[model samples]
Target: MVSRELIARHCICCGGGNLEKSPAVLMPFVALRVFGHEPVEITEDWGLRDLRQGMAYTLCNSLQCQNCGALFLDYRFTDEQMEALYRNYRDELYNEQRIRFEPGYANVPPHYHQRANYLCEVEAWLAPYLPEAPAVLDFGGDSGINSLFREHNQLLHIHDISGVELVPGAERADLERIRQCHYDLVTCSQVLEHVPYPLDFVKQMLPALGTGSLIYVEVPHEALLRAHPGSLQLATCKRHWHEHVNFFTESSMRVLLESLGLVVVDVLHLPVDIGWTQGEVMGLLARQA
Candidate 1:
């Protein structure tokens, strides 16, 4: 692709404009899988629509927040781009089997852990805080399986753009209702990175949370990945530019939460899998002061 100066994005953490490009770059999504920077050559006729051969169509450049140490993809997708990409994201990259498996590992599906290990920490820390028959809202909680692990008797509602949530008895609430309803706990896991304006999105939902309510957040750690390069081959072998747009560091995440007038209760750096020498994702639990 044509090399240009990486756009300086407003830091969600520090509210700074010092985001700069990183040394690491990977292949574009259409050109390859999440394995490396090289093209994987997809010729399986999975509706090969737009084929362009150049740097502009190939490289997925990474950006770093010079002020906060967080890493993110500098490339921002437009409304049209987001629609075209997500329309077939799960179907192509995952469902149709476009993803590549690493050495010695079977081709395991994504969201390999129905109940993420990090959630265990969140679940434990949340026990003392939850009310009797807690009303839980899992924003972007895919399939609502994670809620099953939290509390059985709890009133659970799942909010997701994808309509594939298969949990029994779980209510599907829209943004309007969720914004008005007061929830005991609001979980936003792996959601911020996909949205164009994460700050504005949170601003919209903040009113739905009542006093003493908990907001549990999880995101991939860019700081850990930068420090541990070898672990990346397993975590993100190829670049996923469309989805994981923003990667947060521990310090950056704390600043982001605190900036929104929420007190940080705890921050946990969790491995991708328990006891494995690999990449990490971060979990943050916070509530209004």
Candidate 2:
């Protein structure tokens, strides 16, 4: 295996020039897997490609703006390719095997509890500033399960790329539609990192907010990377290009949001899994100043 350190040194996001064999960081490569050997389609931006697994091939980790500290492995996908991966790809990394639902009772597993805990933390932090059971928009709310917990007082609006029928208020609206409306609170949990452009994504939502409206966002904290070295491998396995492209630290996240004129009200750390690492998991609540 090639050295990750060497890859980092030549990382395009870190490196000064076009992709070259200068350092591993500036230009790194990792073992990648694709399901069913699907069609490798090219994206309009030409930054990504859908690599059909005709044969496993090594490719550059792609260049990112080191100044902004964005490291994306320049891989694009056609809509069909994306659908195939999300629907059919079943592996330890992409395990759809463990169903989180069963029947009448809430299939509330440990993960659900984790989600509940995170939501509770947010509730506490925003309690003094927010109104009782305010309307909330959960960007990328996969199933709207979290909305169930807040059903009593909070009115929930869910937006996601794929329309999930599982949740109650599941909206098939795209991000564009989401940007047009204002809500009392917005919950963007663990979704921003997967976006191709984090800055642009947040900016789109700014016009929709009132002065005191709150935006609650979460991403896999960069500290988690340091806490669990093995996560590097796990990340690659569990849909690297599609799932997450931009990683963030608390400082980075603050800078990104504040630049858009949102005042950072509160920031907290959260773990990906409580059992695995003692890393900092980050949550940020911002409001228009």
Candidate 3:
């Protein structure tokens, strides 16, 4: 396999050069299970030729920004690698490979097909802020199956890199089309954690925001980071990097949006029980400043 370079230099949230780095290990199974690359291939490609005895994973680093307290994996996957990682995303074949490495993964895919219970709470919370029958776009939202207001929206559009078939009433749109169209609400749910450059990813969506447009960004309120709020020592504890690379603090989320000239409407911590797992989500609501 070709070499995959680590591209993260500065903090993705605040763009800070001053970062704290700590040794971390990325399990070899992630290569085969998630990206379809073999363990030995990526280990060699990543230049960890000297795999110590009993070590079957790639040695990497976890970085935390001193400026904004954002924690993420040091590796920033390239576009090609990102494509490979999420190509089949949560589909049957993807689940099979993952289940080969982690048996527990088998229980997760069925939940993906169901309409997320969190969307009900999210829609209700957003109701007072949104207009009646708003035109909505779900960025990186696969199939628009769990998109808020899917049933009530005047127009519902889904922009996803994954080529999954959309559910009824949802139209597939390209990024350029999304930029040209004026959407009242743009929802990017459970996407930031997987992205290598969260800041740049959100910046790309700026053109889609009209004056009254509201952008909703949601990420897992990672337990480890939440347990030790504002602590730089998080890097030492985060030994393994998986699909969810960036773990955002509430302050870091604010900095990310505010830096983009967005007026922060509200930041919420919602408890979610998605059948498979119960966790908290850090949901941020923002509009054009």
Give all candidate RMSDs, comma-separated. Answer: 7.3, 10.3, 4.6
TM-score between candidate 3 and the true structure: 0.90
Q: What's the count of clashing pairs in each model shown?
A: 6, 22, 0
Predicted model with the maximum lDDT = 3
Clashes of 3: 0
Runs in model 2 deviating more than 4 A are: 1-56, 62-68, 76-84, 87-117, 147-149, 169-182, 223-242, 272-280
- Which wins on lDDT, candidate 1 or candidate 3? 3
The sequence of per-residue lDDT tens digits that candidate 2 reaches over residues 21-138 is: 2111111111222233322345455554664324232343433433434344454333454465455333334342323211222232334433344556556666776777677777
Please write out the lDDT profile of model 1 over residues 1-289, one tens digit for every residue.
1122234355545667665544335334533343224445555464557864333335555666566655666555555555655654556444443344232223444554455556666566566767656788888777787762345546788887778745776888888888777888888877787765566556555776787788888776654455754331222332445456776666767777777888888776766663333557677888998
- Candidate 3 regions with alpha-carbon error over 4 angstroms: 1-5, 33-52
TM-score per candidate, chains pooled: 0.73, 0.60, 0.90
Error of 3 at 222 (Å): 0.7
- The parts of candidate 1 lying over 4 Å away from their true place are 1-8, 23-26, 30-57, 92-94, 100-106, 110-113, 148-153, 226-242, 272-279
Select the stronger candidate by TM-score from 1 and 2: 1
* Alpha-carbon lDDT, every model: 0.62, 0.53, 0.83
Question: How would the candidate models be sorted by TM-score, starting from the highest?
Answer: 3, 1, 2
Winning model by TM-score: 3
